[model samples]
Target chain A: MLYIKIADLKIRIENKYNYVRALCKDYIIDECEDYDISVSVSDKEIDDEISVAEVAVSRGYAEGVCVYRNICYQLPVKFNSYLLHSALIEYEGKGYAFAAKSGTGKSTHIAIWQRVFGDKVRIINGDKPIVRYLDGEFIAYGTPWCGKEGFAVNDSVPLRALCFIERSPTNSIERIPASDAVLRVFQQILTPRDAATLDALFPLLDKTLMQVPCYLLKCNMDDEAATVAYNGMNNDN
Target chain B: MKIKSGFVVREVAGQTIVVALGEATKIFNGMIRLNETGRIIWDMLSVGSEKADIVRRITEEYDIDEKTVQADVDAFINTLQGANILE
Candidate 1:
């Protein structure tokens, strides 16, 4: 059994298999007894998730089920949070989230910001980050299941802006209405497949949108694009 | 027919929007924005009211004639049906 602390919750992982333990190597901790939630992974458990037992015979499925069981499925519902598909970055101590469809160049755009600001910007999480409402404000938190790039930190910052990014020949930034922002954000977040979780997700999402400002960013992968987006977002606030 | 189970109507920033819930979200894709009258008619649908019931309630709620309310209700139902949101 391994105890990992993320998003202010102590999660206990009772994995009988070595794959999940190795996958969570960076997150392993010692000397923690009380746990907020406990998840277990085994060959039988994976077989139960899929109808064909043959399909569950792999290390990848074992590791994925563990994270999916804990981070993507259970934690969000329990904590009133959403796992947004975006590249989160911290700038000036405030978190900015850049979101788009897969291969829409969210990482490329954030790279431009890093090129321009050079060390002034830090990626909070490259792929999925938890956006939760706490202390009357919305915050972006990092988790162990940072997407393909493996870029995630065990930290959180106050959410400042959410930009729905799209690839364009020319760069432009437009402030969108809250209603439009809510719909766009709903698509970007990892929505649950059940009714109970969906009910919790809606009000939490609405409250987050009410507190944070949203924008639509159209830009190319150029240094000037970052400058334009940065200036437009900063000047407006 | 009845309105889908997972749809929730909400008012945000003075705009009335209908969001799809759970599995319904996969088919709807995005949210549906409704006007004041549309919101009223949608509320009636939520309670399993029929087309005639919607027309009557809409006519009573607004100053419009029954014929106009019927046409509006037909158009709204058509829109919902086209989106495949009605159960």
Candidate 2:
């Protein structure tokens, strides 16, 4: 069982499948041992718990045989697609993360910004970063969950804005009220089931919204939408 | 219970957490795991329209047998009732 803390929330990631550390169950619980992690092998199989334990490497991703509880899941020893289930990223940065339903082109719009702003911006987390409040300041951290580009960089930065993505004919970026922004981001966030941990999430979100601005970035997969999003974020008051 | 737009719905510890354009407050009790189809049913019910109107929409949209739809709808309604998240 591994204890992980974000904001004030405490979660335990227990590798219970086997020796390879291939299967993990993240629970929002103060007590770690009570949570259960189990898996039944499907087409892909790795001998036993020992193999699962061996696979739990310190700092890199791997393709392996694994399961998410009762559901049999496979992870490419090397994952390149959008980090879907296990990737968790968070940080404290100058800007908030952009979150949306899958296939919403969160990566594409981000590319537009990189092309337009170039040196003015930094790539904090490509996808599914964790955002939390530590002490009194919010922080974001990069997790194993790197989206399409498979760009995983473990770093933290100060958040400023959160942008929701959508492709629209007219390039427009509009501010979303703090209440709405918090809810949207919260939905996209990967949370476990600990009341204390869950409770911390909303408060941090509220705090982040109080200081940072959130917006809906609607535009074609063109630079104009990126421009509108940036301008809107900078202008958020 | 209350419903709102774009609420990120999550199942946490068998509890339903709704982040409805506000906070990630939750409604817990008997759980309803809204699958793709279930979510569609929930979306329809969320419109605040009459149950009969929702039934009409479901009949038009899904290929489900009417009896099955009614049963599913009733089961869903009972689940929500237990959770107190439904009107």
Candidate 3:
């Protein structure tokens, strides 16, 4: 039995199998005398290719949301662990959002900022972070989808900046205008709806874009590049 | 189908917002913005001019080192068409 804890989620898988499928009420869950939090796949979903298993685990007030693909991940992560979906790292903090796609090195950039800011920049969560307009202020928190890095922390902080990164051949940065950055910001946001919330989300996105200052950060993969980007943001304040 | 007019460009939050570029007034689902050159081509088209004359005016006003202003016109119109910014 392997159990991994991601953000506020505790994920455990039992019984070695080739594939992982979503769990439903009809699926069979059992208790092992040797292993606790053991979940087994019912014979039905194992054969169905399209089926998905969603396990609900809770930690403190934070709820666990998980989607599993293979049985290889039955073992738990060493650090605040979360499973990975794709080659991506997304986290959230307070009202401001900092999003970068896979190659953009989202974690590396944030890590550099964290070192510079020290305690001022709290990494509320790592991996897949959730953002919402709570109490009239936007809040970003960590989700369980954190990757193998296992740096998921249970914390929340006020967002101050939004950054978009690109792999550049040169070691220079460009400050983009809000209008030019808004299109990119809208494209990076992760939101879902059931026909009722999409319209609302766009406006929320628009309002958020209008308020935040976003930058186009072009840099190489080096410590100096991170310092340059962080200091540029710090100087504006 | 409407005849193309002139477009007015403005900057909002660092983005160049293009509206009513010349009188054509296309109800575009997606908006379009012209850089330095797009504005120049748009100016000649606004006065109910022909394509050939517009190209002549563009070649004279801009230092663009390219052959066939005709190709540029075709490409620009195609982009506008694809963006639904033209009738």
Write one digit per residue (lDDT tens) for candidate 2, span A107-127: 776777778767555565676
Candidate 2 Cα errors over 4 Å, as ranges: A1-93, B1-87
In model 2, state the lDDT of residue A106.
75
Worst 10 residues of 1 chain A by lDDT: A48-57
lDDT of 1 by residue, A1-237 (tens): 777776677788776667666656666677476777777666666666555434435755555555555565665568766778789999999899988888899888988999999998998888888787777888888877766677778889888999899999999998888878876876687655565765677777777777788889999998988888888778877
DockQ score of each predicted structure, in the order shown = 0.30, 0.07, 0.12
Complex DockQ, candidate 3? 0.12
Residue A129 alpha-carbon offset, candidate 1, angstroms: 0.6
Worst 10 residues of 2 chain A by lDDT: A72-81
Best by the TM-score measure: 1
Candidate 3 chain A — worst ten consecutive residues by lDDT sum?
A: A57-66
Give the better candidate number (1 or 3) by lDDT.
1
Q: Candidate 3 docking category? A: incorrect
Ranking by DockQ: 1, 3, 2
Interface RMSD of each: 3.4, 11.5, 10.1
lDDT of 3: 0.48
- Candidate 3 residue lDDT tens string, B16-72: 445442233434322455666666666555555677776777787775544667798
